[model samples]
Target: MGDFQPEAHVKGSWGLNFIALICKRSSAVFFAVSLLKSIAQMYKVFVNDKPIIFTTSFKNEEDFPVYIYKNTIIQELIYKLKVGKLNGFYIYSNNLIEDWKDFKVKFKVIIAAGGLVLNGSKKVLFIYRGNKWDLPKGRVEEGENLMEAAIREVEEECGIEKLIINKELLITYHLFIQQNEYRLKETHWYLMFSNYEGSLTPQLEEGITKAEFKNKKETIEALQNTFANIVMVYESYLDNID
Candidate 1:
């Protein structure tokens, strides 16, 4: 009882006081084991139930470990995670579970992607949002990295690729919860330059009805009725007459 571990259990030491001691020791060991297991689950990027890429561990609601499990089955886990009582997160791989103190993720990360392509003297791109004109951006798929998904979305939504990234824009957005559901989005924008000359192709499957190019004057006109973030960075990449 003085030094008991769940990983080490035995029969034939069936005393009442001894049982109590062993129970206490095994409790701590179980907590630690479950904690490690939770950590191991986060480092995977799942695509259709299979892992494709290994990124920093991300947490879902299922990872939070309960106390002596003080609160209840679900409530205690939720309360512990929300109040930061159980802040320890591990990044496990292969057969080792290591601590991940830096990138402690929240729950439900959704990434939206967009890119900028250049065409001749004009530097412009097209985007289509829900029933509105906007940048061609969509959610990143599981097991896909930020830039890879971004490039794919651009190619699919605009029918253009072979781009050279100028720079990656900031990932910014808001968080809101719906009825009995919670979701968070991490949108990473990019400025990519491409030399494709095919006609603009809007992804019909995604409801992208139009894809077009614009000159400086037309780009300004297009910017007037677009997403807020699109307009914010539109002028930064304008064509300069030398």
Candidate 2:
């Protein structure tokens, strides 16, 4: 694990034991574990770009088929992910963390950076692209640190100047297919502030149609149409402010 440490904790619910582990793999995978007097971890396998969090406690859902296993191995799970054609599926297991750790080493990883930008009026910056509301972010360029790339991407995408990174925020992960191969993206988020009063311009070449600062109400409305990870980031920002 080369300096990689898993974050672990335990919580009790209804006299049952619950263990949570944050595994720092190529992508950060959160495991919400359940235990029978002893701690256990769950697996979140990404299939077709959607995540299916599998646990021993999960009941069958209507959308995805549930696979029950008494001794699920890592190879079988990997095969299912590579060959299966469903949106996602669940695998119930007690030793999922060990399997997940082995599964993570099979993929290529990409690191990215983005910012949650705040303006002088306390409005948050957002971009409209691909018919969805999103924050201004992109892949970190070579020779530039995460902070530098975050600030640069925000300024370039939103046509803003003098943007300052206030602090590092939470990290998020998602899977994508590029060049017919699966890859994991680890996005580093930062809280940023800017006071520019000039006209905003969205980077047209990047398919961004509009870039503007939105108030709290507008931000909430945008969240309805944004990605899950963006919603999580925005919610974290809200928690900090409150």
Candidate 3:
């Protein structure tokens, strides 16, 4: 195992303390929540685009199967999590944080940046890609800082300029497999304000089909079909503004 470094710190949507880690060899992302001291709540972490939720209680009416466990070896638990067929699982443990720290050391990490762009009219910018609504973002480039990469990606993907980064918003983490390699991506998000009034053009080369600023009603509709991370960013933005 290589040295585990803090790649990003994520403020959990459900009030869980979360940390994203990166190591040297593999690309594994871990999200661990401690529920031993409080009421049982659901905690989510995406792996290879699949959401693996950790919880304490089992609902009888759940549409998906849940694996219940008391305690297990860290290596065996990770193997089961990686190869499990179920939608989610639960583990009862008093050392949730330490267990996750051990499990996270098995992978490499990639850092990315993105923006929640709002125009002068208060509409938020969105892009359609792979038949889903998404925000403009990309991997951080060489020699570029996170802030610069975020502004550049938003400008390039949406074909808009004059993006002013208002403040740092939230950090999101997700796991993905690329070229047969498991990878973790830590995305730093920024709240941005843009005054560009030009017609929006999606970056076709990036598989983006449309880029447009959406009003409140349109945003609500779009959120119904966006990714969990995107929804988190938008909701965090809303919380700060209100």
Candidate 4:
């Protein structure tokens, strides 16, 4: 966990330096094992536009710097983030799950499902809600799996039928305050396809002002006024199709 010391491959004397060489190899092996395990459980939770990444491997070459979790406090980090003291930060720990538990316990988790819909014209569907461009999604209801909920939400919110989920996309997390308590909304997204070229209807009660399919150029322009999490979903969709 200190400054990384890359394992050397030079042959050395067996009598004097054999024990030191064995110790070095052991350290390298331990690091490699920890990194692999951490990679499997990595998560990025968005607080507004800033991300709090939880992982043991400092793999991302982004501007955010990794901080050892054992030596840092979660509340302190969040406070700094709120006051604009930090743009974003990473929480690196060998015990990744335990550290994540400490962070997750801080909020009431809400699960939702939604979709990125592509039509026969190869255009993507978007909804304008809360004064920002967003994909169609809603909270998960009882007795429904993630996929069913996603399709249902898209149909109900955008008034589009005959929607077919092509594949499961990624999950995104964002925090908001509701009724004086912090809540984390976990959205499950899917890549969907629909051939319905009929009129698009935005759910009025949900405050959706527009529901329309956009071409590549229009989609790129809409991203400028959307939330960070929405951008992540669209980017993931692009990655899957490409």
Top candidate (TM-score)? 4
Worst 10 residues of 4 by lDDT: 1-10
Off by over 4 Å in 2: 1-49, 54-101
**What does the lDDT come to for candidate 1?**
0.48
Per-residue lDDT tens digits for candidate 2, residues 17-82, read: 111111122121122112211223344434433455545554334445566554545345544656
lDDT of 1 by residue, 67-135 (tens): 221122433433444455654222233321222111114446566777766676655777655655567
List runs of model 4 lying over 4 Å from the truth. Answer: 1-41, 59-62
| Model 2: residue 105 alpha-carbon error in angstroms | 2.2
Candidate 4, residues 49-155, lDDT tens digits: the string is 66777775665435566788879877788767767787677788788767777777788988999999999999999999988788999999999988999999999
TM-score of each: 0.50, 0.68, 0.70, 0.78
Query: Of models 2 and 3, which has the larger TM-score?
Result: 3
Question: Which residue pairs overlap in candidate 3's backbone?
Answer: 26-107, 26-108, 27-108
lDDT to native, each model = 0.48, 0.64, 0.64, 0.72
Of the two candidates 3 and 4, the one with more favorable TM-score, higher being better, is 4
Best by lDDT: 4
Q: Mark the regions of model 1 whose C-alpha exceeds 4 Å error after superposition.
A: 1-107, 175-182, 235-242
Total clashes in model 3, counting residue pairs 3 or more apart in sequence or in different chains: 3
By TM-score: ranked, best first: 4, 3, 2, 1
Worst 10 residues of 2 by lDDT: 17-26
